[model samples]
Target: MAKYTLTVNGGNKEVEAMEDMPLLWVIRDLLGMKGTKFGCGQALCGACTVHLDGVAIRSCSLPVSSVGEGKITTIEGLSEGCDHPVQKAWVQHNVPQCGYCQSGQIMNAAALLTANPTPTDEEIEQGMAGNLCRCGTYNRIKEAIVTASKSL
Candidate 1:
C-alpha cells in the first residue's frame, strides 16, 4: 500500500491504498463520498464519472496512485446548495428519473459546458454520448444542457 494525497474539491485528502486501487473506491469507500457512484467497474458506464483537474474522467478506471496531484471534483462538490447552473437546469427541466446516473450526467455536462459554453445539439450529443441514463432521459438531458448554456 502507498499513501496518496489528492486535491479533491479544493481540499487535500490523503489516503493509503494500493497503487492499482481505483479512485472510485477511494472516494466512495475511504473518503466516504458517495456522490460518485459505481455502475460498471470496467469504465464502460459513466456512473463513475468525475472531474480530474476539470476534465471528465472515468473514476472507476483511474487508479488512485495515477491521480498524482490532480484535482478531483465529485457531484457533491459541484455546488454548495445544488445551485450550479447545470443542476438548476436539471431541476427546471425535471431531468432525473432513477437519479442513479444523474450525478455523472451532471458532472459530464458541467465539464462539457466548461469546455464549450455553448454547444450545438450535435456537440451536446457527442459530448454526452458516454453517459448513459437507463431511464432514457436523453431529450431532457439535452434540453437541460441547452438551458444551462443559456444561463451561463
Candidate 2:
C-alpha cells in the first residue's frame, strides 16, 4: 500500500492504498464521498467525474497516487447547503429523471461554468458531451445549464 495525501472537498486526507487503486474507489469507498459515482470503470462514462485543480476529470481511471497535491471537488463540495446555482437550476428545471447521472452531469456543468460563465448552447453541448443521461434529459440539462449560467 502507498500513502497518498489528497485534498478532497476542501479537506486534507491521507489515504493508504495500492498505487494503482482508482481515485473513484479511494473517494467513494475509502473516503466516503459517494457523490462521485461508479459507472463504466473503464472511464467511458462520465459518472465518476470530479474536479482536479478546477478541471473536470474522470476519476474511475485516475490512480490515487496520481492526484498528489491537487485539490479535488466532488458534487458534495459544490455547495454548503446544495444551493449552488447549478443545483438550484437543476431543481428548477427538473433535470434529473432516474438521477443516476446527475452528479456527473452537475460536475461537468460546474466545470463548464467555471471555465466559461456565459457558454453558448454549442459550448454546453461540447462540454457536457461526455456525460450521458440514460433518462434522455439532454434538452433539460442544457436548459438548466443556461439557467445556472445566468444565475451564476
Candidate 3:
C-alpha cells in the first residue's frame, strides 16, 4: 500500500491505498464522495469524470498515486451554494430523465464552459462527446449548456 495525499473539493485528504487502486474507488469508498459515479471500470465511460488540476479526467482509470496534491473537484465542489449556473440551467431546461448520467454530463459541461465560456455548437458536441446519456437528452443538454454559458 502507498500513502497518497489529494486536495479534493477544497479540502486536503490523506489515504492509504494499493498502488494500482483507482482514484474513483478512493474517492467513493475511502473519502465518501459519492458524487463521482462508477459506471464502467474502464475509461470508456465518462461517469467517473472529475476535475484534476482543472482538467477533466476519468477517475476510474487514474491511479491514486498520480493525483498527489492535485486539486480535485467532484460534483459536490461544482457549486459553493446550490446555484451554479449550469445547475440552474439544468433545472430550467429540465434535463434529467433517469438522472444517473446527469452528474457526469454536468461535470463535462462545466469543464467545457470553463475552458471556453462561449463554445460553438461543434465545440459543445466535441467536448461532451465522451459522456453518454442513456435517456437521449442531448438536445436538452446542449440547450442547458448554451443557457448556462450565457448566464455565466
Best of the candidates, TM-score: 1
Better of 1 and 2 by lDDT: 1
Instruction: Give one digit per residue, the lDDT tens place, for model 1 in 21-84.
Output: 9999999999999999999888887999999999999999999989998899999998999999
Instruction: Report every candidate's CA lDDT.
Output: 0.96, 0.93, 0.90
- What stretches of model 2 exceed 4 Å from their correct place? none
- Compose the digit string of candidate 2's lDDT tens values, residues 1-152: 98888898899988999999999999999999888999899878799999999999999999988998999999999899999999999999999999998999999999999999999999999999999888999999999999999987
TM-score of 1: 0.99
Could you estimate the TM-score for every candidate?
Answer: 0.99, 0.98, 0.96
Question: 93, model 1: CA deviation in Å?
Answer: 0.5
Candidate rank order under lDDT: 1, 2, 3
The ten-residue window of minimal lDDT in model 2 covers 36-45
Clash pairs (backbone) in predicted model 1: none
Kindly report which residue pairs in candidate 3 clash with one another: none
